[model samples]
Target: MAARLPPGNQRHDGEYEDLLSLWSDLESALSVVLSAPLRVQDFPAKVRQVDRWLQDLVAHDIDAALYLMFQLASTSSVGYSASHALVCGTLCHIMAQELQLPPRERDSLVRAALTMNIAMTALQDVLAGQREKPTAAQQDAIRNHPQESQALLERLFITDNLWLDVVGQHHASISDRVPLASQEPHDRLTRILGTIDRYAAMISPRKSRAGRSATDSVRAIVGHEVDQRDEVSYTLVRSVGLCPPGTFVRLDNGDTAIVLRRGEKANQPLVASLLDRAGAHHARPGIYQTGMTNKPRIQSALARSAVAVALNHRTMVRLGVYAAAPHNSGLMGLVTVPGAL
Candidate 1:
């Protein structure tokens, strides 16, 4: 079980509080939809609510929001589908902002990313725990999930063409076989979603495989033939930085730390020190600004297997690694409070 946040009066910026609350609401909404037997009638409303929050974050505190969402990817005990949706939505929003996409287009992408896997929510959760390759039945479901998700959305009254189109084509690949001239704007959106989806999934751990290292995942995405020309790929790599949040790294000073946020430089990111030079876990991890010359610099991104220590979300929050963000101060406390998870 996850640890509870210690009781205290924590101060945070209002924007951070709002974003945390919105994130909680989204989790609750998704939990209900995924666990219940009937389709959630208010699913569209929930998507809109999350869309508004994403728009707000993009407009005001995007970096903090991205960090929070990435942290949630590990901290969230919710099944894979909910966590993946949140991560994908956050990444889509960040990439869209980097691309300077118009507000309407950005929101549509966010919405599409959030709901693209709705049809296979339960199956995704099941797959996360299975070590073998998917069965033929599961394979068929995976192949048709995009269209099924779109149909479900239509039944729920989602009328935006952009939202519908992006959701439907989310799994579609851009092929050398298909002429680029035939691609539409929605296809571009699909490419963005696909790139982010695969990248996020690769970095996330599952029963079948340990998650890829941050640097390795970036290299894979950048090296992909289909994604080589996709600007979204570059934007994702830049926005998340070389050491994205939640990634573990070894420092030049012989300490191990988990990245907390991106810094001005791609390789220099904010991090929370976990192990000291002697390789002992600290009682309380210290947040460091790797961009500062006096601070220890990152030597390399560490693979998951290389780090033997087990760090949980509650511990990360209690250590204040994520607390530096103006809006994030009180969130960790709130998220770990009794029953909050």
Candidate 2:
């Protein structure tokens, strides 16, 4: 049965719609190799299945696309680099779609996403047990996988070297001096995709300090040359609720919401109400727009339990008082924010 979201969930419609689409596509693609051994030789064929899905994303609501992509890539499990590429590519497509870029640019974003994590599969096996502690080199390798993915893509035959080159240099800081050995062509859309591709990976939940809020993530991205920071920033901000993506937050108005939707216009995100401190849903699954409350709004996107336990975190720092633990784990499915947040 198609999973139905309860009413009162502000983002339930949009998020759930996107999720259903993504699940249908992912299931169809992964099913081909579900029984096959997990190996690189079989990756291309499997990825080809995902190609139709990427092509389908060409016209989707970009915000939903990005949110869905982030959900797929930034999980604790399924840390394979290949998975990263798929997710990242999906994100790039969302960015392109949002900007209404040309077909070539959209295609480039998909190609780049598919290749960015080429090296990740090699290291994905290592991620299984290192959820808590990772070695310096492991972390470094993970960070540099873009380059590693490029090299691997070089060995594999691809019609366009442009994507591999972009994937290789995707992580290259705008200030990096080494003339990247890249010659693949690109248009404005392609460049934007490349930029978003890198940004998505950077601000992902586990990639950095888990506490980094979406706003900070946007500021960090502004350092790069991507245009219209306001749009991307707001999209990320509004997509998730008062709680930033990856971080858990409780709102005032006596409600506990998770950051699942980003808005390019406001400060608050489209939050999905999970529980109240007393363990009830005072508010429905919807957006809690965080505005200039005449109080100190807890803006930090920190780990939930840690902050709650260590600091004795109370209910909605900005609103009134309503706090609880997260419950619903279903994909937000890229639901739209109901202007309220």
Candidate 3:
């Protein structure tokens, strides 16, 4: 969890403290080739080094791990394969906490999430960037990715079959059409990874302009995952959607907010609470509790529809709110909106 500040000064502290550092690590790692040659060379060693580092960090700070993973998921472009692993890790952390999953299970979940896409860095970059679809070479690379990722995992001595299974079957659907010898069970990791992969593919602004808001994106992803064959998909996607990156919200008491962080708890969207009536600036790291209610009562109610109702930027604004306005005439925040006029 982030260090908490007192009630009134919340606006000053911002969330995602280590976002840059995490981004640096993510970009740096993805910059290297990890498929065949690199794997044969020393990329596997580098991958293990990073994983070991992350594990050491995770033992003490899951929140930091989550923060790192979230930023990586939202911004990293070297490859979605790598991006997928990070997103999965972030989702697992948040989901595990919400589901009250066991610690060992949570650890396993995070480990699997991180390594799932290591073998598909090429395809990952294609998905993360505006690059052309994986070429015949990339396609050939992909069909063999399970083997590639597994081979790397084995080389790295990653012990869990659970990790291998999710990493291997990520693109595989349960159609009898697949000549595969057997199938895997529906569980936390599969659900989390599946959803993260689909959502990442959809919201990639690099993909198209039909860009959807956080809520809309969640709705769309959840809808896509609803078929009987895709219940786990639905659950995972729905869970992640609860707090898409950059989600803005309002409290019941006329406060506007933005989601700066997402915890393992699907219901709670970690928000940066804006204190000013106009919402020009927010208390950087202000976080209210998750769910409909909170441990400590929220002082102000956010106005969702209020934004639509042109803020009465007019001078002599609502006395109760405008009392603190800079000028006696009434100045909301720094500038008055046309609506105020």
Candidate 4:
């Protein structure tokens, strides 16, 4: 059953609707650029336009951007390459700000991320839907795609050496023990992009397997078992939280909730419960701000495959906006602010 949002939540705000529309448009625009760069008249200009669009989207409201990105990545109707590029590019943009990367370096890093897999675009889409392991030839192609992508960009008249070099070495391995600040500019960006690339891929699903839960994915990247957290991994966790919005969590009280926003604290995200302890759908999902006093805390992250709720994401996003609104009275006993908790 589709759980209805509560009465006041039924309506959408114009700004929220605009944000959704903007994201949808950006997705389409990016798909065009990534899928057919040769066909684009002014390729570099087009890339910049898309990058500016992404920056604006992220700057407008990062939580909304993450909510939409994770939701698309989990259940993408588009090709895997495009979806993956968007996720990587978005993360790069966010990381740039968090890492305080200089303007030129950030530009090169993000552009490289968006174009890194261009050489394998079709193959990537095919691989996502193929249950079987990659063939030997496909493996070879994947191994060679980074350099090929760089060469292709050069042919397309991209004269940015930093951008080209970053794409070429995006898959290069640097010692994890090395400090990011000590590396050359290109190497630092490469390390940052490489870490974001892996993290993005792990959370996205494919026919071959279900994607890991966000927490598990982060744990893998952060190397929690070995207790060696790289700067990129630490920054990622600090910026996006262990479970960002658009992911799911199991609560201590036995309800399954979808994350709506990053709370004042990372672990205490604002979530809306779709299923009760009995595993039945609720008529109206209950909103809970977890980690307040610790009663209804999150027990663990849930993989998108683990929960089968079909969400009305716009409505969910609206609930988040309302929760953050300055003048909103608490709805259905909802706490308006995490601080209030």
Cα lDDT tens digits, model 3, 1-341, are 11233334233222223333554575456445344434445544555565555555444444335434443444334455555555555556566655556666666666666666677666665654654665788778868876677777876666667767777766664442222213333244555556655665554344423223444455576553355344444445445545443444555554665444444465455444444456554423234554545422223322122233222111111221222223434212323223221
Best by TM-score: 4
Q: Put down candidate 4 lDDT per residue, 1-341, tens digits, no spaces.
A: 22334456534555677888898788778888878889988899999999999999898889989999888888763488888999999999999999899999999999999999988888998999999999999999999999999999998899999999999999998766788889998899999999889988998899998888988998887765423347788788777878899999999889999888888776788898888788787766777778877458999999899987787676778777677666666444432222101
For model 1 the TM-score comes to 0.79
Q: Which lDDT tens digits does candidate 1 get at residues 258-288?
A: 8766788878888877788888766556668
Per-residue C-alpha lDDT of model 2 across residues 50-70, encoded as one tens digit per residue: 766665653443434444454
Q: Report lDDT (Cα) of residue 254, candidate 3.
A: 49
Whole-model lDDT for model 4 versus the true structure?
Answer: 0.84
- Candidate 4 similarity to native, TM-score: 0.91
Cα RMSD (angstroms) for every candidate in the order listed:
5.7, 9.3, 10.5, 4.3
Candidate that scores best on lDDT: 4
Question: What's each prediction's TM-score?
Answer: 0.79, 0.58, 0.54, 0.91
- The C-alpha stretches of model 1 lying farther than 4 A from their native spots are 1-10, 13-22, 34-38, 56-60, 75-78, 175-183, 224-229, 283-286, 291-294, 303-341
lDDT of 4 at 97: 94
Q: Which ten residues in a row have the lowest lDDT in candidate 1?
A: 332-341
